[model samples]
Target: MLNIVLFGPPGAGKGTQSQKLIDTYSLIHLSTGDLLRSEIAAGTELGLRAKTLMDQGILVPDEVVIGMIDTKLKENRNAAGFIFDGFPRTVKQAESLDSLLDQNNTAISGMIALEVNEEELTKRLLLRGQTSGRPDDQNEELVRKRVQEYNTKTAPVAGYYANQGKYHAINGIGEIEEIFTEICEIIDSYATQLNA
Candidate 1:
């Protein structure tokens, strides 16, 4: 399977590029945020637990997230591949994901991170805030804090993937098509290597 982890900070155009990648690659998009919402909407046992925690302003445990991911994998067993977005935020979570994928006889092909400058990210987020109606995106300080939080917490996840030789960084400041081309090139290279 051509599983990919689409990594990027807030306002890095991950949402835009993720849609294009899904169309071009025919990969199931497994976004954790979406998964959580779906699970809650379904009112599964795990979902109840997660909802309770969320309602109490506490983070849902990793195992809960992993369980949701496991369910998704089973549901999409016939999928060509998966594109993971906004997940595996820490090294421990990354390791857990690797173990889970291994159990399914699949592995992450690579993580493609969109590299964007802080200034550009803030600009894009503020512009999006004008329309997105997301409070965090509307505030410059919140946007910067989110970006810095990603850097602080998720940078090590990048390093973990780097050690496994499954990290790919691409410039995210160009035209959308251009950026997508760069990402595709990286993904295609991995595809070629895997099939070889």
Candidate 2:
């Protein structure tokens, strides 16, 4: 399996790159946010709980998020691999994911971190807000808070992966295609190593 973790800040285009990777490699895209939304939309028990917290503008507890992810992973067991986006945001979660994958006899192949300047992120986020209509994006204060939260809570996970020698930093400032190319190179390198 070619399991990958796509890690980056909010406006770093992790989603875009993940999509490209999925298309090129046929990896299952396992986005926590998307999974939660799907569960909520399906009105599952976990989704209901997550919806309550989300409705109140609070983050869902790690256990609930992990439960949702566990379900998705099972469903995609036959996939070529998985592209994890917006997950393992904490050290505990990262450890938990490792245990889960270990139990399944699989492991993370690599973590791709898209590196972008904070100023560029802010600018891109503001522009995205104009069209996205997401409340978090529309509110500057909320946007800043989200960025801070990412830096404080999620950024450390990069270091954790780096320590494992599975972290690759991709420069995120450039045309979309250029950035995708850079990411592709990293993925190709890992794929080669894995096949070898």
Candidate 3:
């Protein structure tokens, strides 16, 4: 399997690039946010739990998120691979993900990080906010805080992948196609190594 963790902060073009990667690589996109929403939409047990927490303004526990992922993994057992987006926000979650994947006899090929500076991310998010209608995206301060929070929380997840030699960083300041090309090169390299 060619599982990948698509890592980036808000407005880093992860959504855009992951879609392209999915098209190019035929990988299932396993976004936690999307997963939660779907589970809620389906009104499953996990979804009800997640919805309750969300309604109460509390973060759903990692175990719940992992259970959702586990269900998705089983549902898509015959998938070519999966591209994980917006997940493993902490080292503990990263470890949990690793253990879960190990139990399923597959592993993440690598984490592809989109490296964008704060200024650009803020600008992009602010621009997106004008039309996106997300209250957090509309505020410059909130955007910065979100990015900072992402760095503070997710940097160690990057380190976890780095320690495992599965971290790949690419410059995120460029045309969409160009950035995606760079990401593809990294993924292709890992795929080659895996096949070899």
TM-scores, one per candidate: 0.87, 0.91, 0.89
Residue lDDT tens for model 2, 1-196: 8899999888899888889889999999988878888888899988898888765546678887777778777888888889999888888899999988887779899999888877888888888999976555677666676777888888999989999999998888889898888888888888898889
Clashing pairs in 1: none
Best-to-worst ranking by lDDT:
3, 1, 2
Candidate 1 versus the native: TM-score?
0.87
Task: Evaluate model 3: give its TM-score.
Answer: 0.89
The sequence of per-residue lDDT tens digits that candidate 3 reaches over residues 78-129 is 8989999988888999999999999999999999999999999999999999
Which pairs clash in the backbone of model 3?
Answer: none
At residue 69, give the lDDT of candidate 2: 71
Better candidate by lDDT, 2 or 3: 3
Q: Is candidate 2 or candidate 3 better by TM-score?
A: 2
Instruction: State residue 104's C-alpha deviation in candidate 3, in Å.
Output: 0.8
Off by over 4 Å in 2: 43-45, 55-58
lDDT of each: 0.86, 0.85, 0.88
Better of 1 and 2 by TM-score: 2
- Ten contiguous residues with the weakest lDDT in model 3: 51-60
